[model samples]
Target: MTHPLTSLSGKKGLIVGIANRHSIAYGCARVLKAQGAELAVTYLNAKAEPFVRPLADELDASLVLPLDVEKPGELETVFDAIREQWGRLDFVVHSIAYCPLEDLHGRVVDCSLEGFQQAMRVSCYSLIEMARLAEPLMKDGGTLVAMSYYGAEKVVENYNIMGPVKAALESTVRYLAHELGSQGIRVHAVSPGPLKTRAASGIAHFDALIDAAIERAPQNRLVDIDEVGATCAFLVSDAARALTGDTLYVDAGFHIMG
Candidate 1:
């Protein structure tokens, strides 16, 4: 028998921002599917499709669509398909974030206006758009989970412009939770310890960040995608239904250090 708190059987979910097998989105998809939830996964574009499609297949995703959040119609298209195919949504895992290389490697003060705008749009605003599109589909009320990082709370070297952007993302989670709470919708940010991911690779000196995490974390180790996924799986389940608008760290106690 499945435990009601952990089992996701019969629930339908949409996962955005899967770039490859190593993506956090993929990890969440893996666990969610394992717990019996049906999923709809998206790739960024044709270039990403080849990599993401196979993983989606492995998860037995009911819908594998292209979703370039920056593209005008693409985001809407994915939700449209979900409504047409499943008529409702149970949860959404948003794991996409970006910043132009120039802005990312430079000091936050040196960040160009264009770069700042682009980072906010892709990394922060996209979640708001996803929540808007997801609201109607989450008829029975659902969850929205966004990936965040420890840098959002405290400055981390080389994290640069993304730090402020993620701070905004965290704030968005709180506001969304408040606005959507009355309808039974829950929102959360999952901040994981440093790990080698395609997105993290864009940060300059990312290795230093990983090393620092391992040295300072209470567990004295970095958390893997699977560990992050387990935390997200709980947030997406009914066991965490009462929790919302909070940042849950899966960083092995690293966030608690002075």
Candidate 2:
């Protein structure tokens, strides 16, 4: 028999921020679908729809829509579609983050005000917005998982402005979990070790970071997208009902090093 905790049958979820096959959001979507969860997947814009559409079809997503958090009404439009089609939601995977090249490649101290604000809005505040919109739909309770990184806690050599942005995201997860627990809603941040996703490509010296993680991590290897997906699959499953307000690490034990 399929374990009740691992099976996501009848559950409905929304995944935001799939830029390509290598995206963290795509990884999460793949596992969730494999676990039998119905999904609603979003693409960033017209430019991204072509790339994401094929993946959505492969997942058999019930709803495929555009969701650019910065664009007015786009977020609400997605939630509205979910409400109309499914009437409820069980989980949401938020895997979006952005910082302009100039800001991301430079020192945090040199980041422009606009760049800092934009990064925080996209990477951190968007989670808050998602939680708010998802709350009403998760009537029986649900889980909210956001992608985070080890750099959110420690200063990595080339992780620059996104470090503080993700720090804020982790804090948001804790606060949201506390506030929503009464409603049976849980929130968490999944921090994966260095990945080779398109988003990670934006970071300067990311290849070096990945190599260092493989060498220093206790597991003596790097975690892959599917591994991260499996961790997220667990997070959004009934087996993880007791876990919330925490940052779960899927980083091959790299976060423990000095």
Candidate 3:
């Protein structure tokens, strides 16, 4: 047996937003699965299945699901499947975020109404939706985590509308923590330094961001998904019972720089 502070053996968790091998969600899923947690993992759509299924099979995930949170009835279907299979949820890792290409490239002020609304709904509101749906399933109390970026706090060029969107997501984490605390539920925002993930490809000049993170971070290096996953594993473990509504930076001290 492993250390209880980090052992998730026999626990159950849902992992969303794994687009491919390089995804941060994939990293989190890998670590959780390694710790013996049974996982319920999602792919964005049919085109994504080939990539995700292999990983799920590798992890021995209990359920490999199609979870387009934007699609009608889709989110409910996933939760329904989870209820039918495990009947309880011990943790969740939410790493999905979306923004239209134009809005992502444009100034925040120029973001279209539709794009802004869609971004908020998918990136921020989805976390709230998951927390509400998981509350009852977490009868013994559990942990909920979502991915965030430094963009949520400070101005990061080319981050554009996502800056505000992530800000909203971080704030939602706090409110959910407060509302769910009595039940022993914990909520957190894990902000990682920029990496070369498929999702990061959406941002213009992301290479620059990656380079900047390394150059400025005290460690003089970038963080990998495994590093981020290690922290996620800890946060969901019983050892982190006293922590809630906080943002955990797995950014290699990048946030400490000017």
What digit string (tens of lDDT, one per residue) describes model 3 on residues 1-258? 779788898899999999888999999999888888899999999999999999999888889999998998999999999999999999999999999999999999899999999999999999999999999999999999999999999999999999999999999999999999999999999999998998889999999998999899999999999999999999999889999999999999999888
State the displacement of the C-alpha of residue 112, model 3, in Å, after optimal TM-score superposition: 0.3
- Residue 138's lDDT in candidate 2: 97
Write down the lDDT of every candidate, Cα atoms only: 0.93, 0.94, 0.94
Give the poorly placed runs of model 1, Cα more than 4 Å off.
none
* Model 3: ten consecutive residues of lowest lDDT: 1-10
Sort by lDDT, best first: what order?
2, 3, 1
The pairs that clash in candidate 2 are none
TM-scores, each model vs. reference: 0.99, 0.99, 0.99
Which lDDT value does model 2 have at 87?
95
Tens-digit lDDT string for candidate 2 (1-258): 668988999999999989999998999999999999999999999999999999999999999999999999999999999999999999999999999999999988899999999999899999999999999999999999999999899999999999899999999999999999999999999999988999999988888998999999999998888998999999999999999999999999999999
Clashes of each: 0, 0, 0
Query: In model 1, which residue pairs have backbone atoms overlapping below 3 Å?
Result: none
Candidate with the larger lDDT of 1 and 2: 2
